[model samples]
Target: MKNIETTLRNVGTVSLVGAGPGDPELLTIKAVKAIAAATVLLVDDLVSPAIVALAPPGARVIHVGKRGGCKSTPQAFIEKLMVMAAREGETVVRLKGGDPFIFGRGGEEVEHLRAQGITVQVINGITAGLAGITSLGAPLTHREHAHGVLFITGHVRPGDSDTDWRAIAATARDARLTLVIYMGVRGSAHIQEELLTGLPASTPVAVIQHVSLPDQRHALTSLGQLHSTIERDQLTSPCVIVVGDVVRGVAAARAPEALRRIA
Candidate 1:
């Protein structure tokens, strides 16, 4: 881990701050301070507008949006913009949804910045998977059901690197672990088939969308029906899919009133 405090003294420093999972209240005090002090704010698509509003007046707020399977600002361009702004003695804040280091490409950005001799600091934020499971009333790690949890991305395709979801499924079964998959909605069908090879068909599953937000919604199902459940519920992107016995805990904990309302 790079020492952030030592880098802060350098001029034109850049801070990579995690904006948390679609909720302004989830922002860390350190992240908030960095946003307030930023001279240039580079925002991601999933970052809540309420958080962006916290930037200081007269700050240059640029929307360098990046969404999977959608038109996005090129990564190289965004990196160049950040480097240019910092070289001009601006405090650049690369604000992203979720912890930047977790599949947010924070490491790449940090490497690019450091290569340019730009001072860089990182501030952690609550990732969507953590927020999503908690909001659904699920304990990620339950000693009785799940001894541990695995965070993986479900965006893998056939031609992509060999992720070996089957092997992971076998491990999860043997280890009694929960699997939290980010960006799993689009690839749920394939992921379900792969996991079903090792895991039982009846493994509990939960798909949470827009977690922690006012309009958040989720669906609970079994691994065998994961794809069907998503299709039937009309669930879309920006979803977190959890698979394991731990999901049963979330289903069991559903408030009676909430259940009645849904019914």
Candidate 2:
């Protein structure tokens, strides 16, 4: 038992880290420690440059960017690099944007590491969905307007079943749930169409782009005007789409004629 414990102690560890939104100040104390102590960092595309600068001067930094609709480093290659580094007795950190577990593919990386007998741990960070809604000074779930909150993805992996937006709209309407959709910009029109089948055309919605960053922008509109609003605002990928009456919770989201101006 003592010998086994000693052997494990000498093995290098891998930390799956969440880099928060774009703000470096949002970093957790533990995340900072892990990053500062890292020997190698596998950084995601959306991770803030400021956060990457937190690594020790001698620490190796490698960008393994994975973005929607863009050329990116292959996931298989990234995982392979992690395993190689850990077995070579290097402390590896996989830095991802937002919370590691929230659609960051941290789970798949963790499984791959564990299968290779590498020690791994995950440090939590603020998810973009929460940050995006909060940036608008609105709660995802309001006791009066929303009783539940659904954090769903607008994108799906290959060979995986696609999301049923219409059915989701039906459930959200009947249950008074708020929907936070990530990676949903390209599909906004189709989502809006299906959602309108079950939800009201006038349902309040907010599309927040680059949430928590200096370039952050948002537009408040109705479900019926979602796609048009996104187009008019020129909102692109990496945006969070908050749908439901909870959007109306924001003073800026409220309107006399039921169409608050988009920014």
Candidate 3:
């Protein structure tokens, strides 16, 4: 173990780490230490149990995860917990899924901790888009096929119907680009419909559920059949949806490898 001086210099130090999609092996070395040294662990809804098991046996673990249209732990309470833990001179670890700042409200937590004079450190991990696509053997950017990629989230507030569907659809249609959608299950039906206006229904799509985990499943289908396929497959939350011609290539490559692994 390193000297206490190295770890204790920052009295109310809080490290916010991205836990990746669902694979424990994907955790960074710094993130692992933060977990092992944490006096308290604050986790979001999307974090998996495999990662949480890394914390010291006696460390306190709290869940402050928020989901759409559900009763969520108040953000104020979560911030207060971090501040209180730090004031007690405890090294705190706030674990979030994917990149903390990306759609994870990690910025809000950091802001709150800083306001309370707590030092914060961030450790990045493979986000869902990269992990999801890689698991299916898909490349978001290809020199020959795609020159760029766009990441978007489908989760939005009610009454906020304003969106740039045309812009996104146009890119998908005209350019060598791939579109990755996070938390997209709820609005997938509508997104597919809107995309049809700008892109072809024949475009390939892949939806990955519980990515990188043992139970992870990926379905490859066309945009026209995507909604129905998901319904039939019974995929749930914590899934990533990718749409583009590149999806077909990924499916073609991964299907045989996945089958051989199973065999």
Q: Per-residue lDDT tens digits of candidate 1, residues 162-236? A: 578999999999999999999888888999999999999888888999978888999888888899999999999
The predictions' CA RMSDs to the true structure, in order, are: 4.8, 2.7, 5.3
Residue 101 alpha-carbon offset, candidate 1, angstroms: 0.7
Tens digit per residue, CA lDDT, model 2, 126-178: 99999999988789988899999999998887799879988999999999999
lDDT, residue 261, model 3: 26
Off by over 4 Å in 2: 1-10, 252-263
For model 2 the local lDDT of residue 147 reads 98
> In model 2, how large is the Cα lDDT of residue 82?
94
User: lDDT for each of the candidates?
Assistant: 0.89, 0.90, 0.82
What lDDT score goes with residue 27 in model 2?
89
On the 0 to 100 scale, the lDDT of residue 189 in model 2 is 87
Worst lDDT window (10 residues) for model 3? 254-263
- Candidate 3, residue 3: CA error in Å? 26
What lDDT does candidate 3 reach at residue 62?
94
Q: List candidate 1 stretches off by more than 4 Å.
A: 1-10, 157-159, 255-263
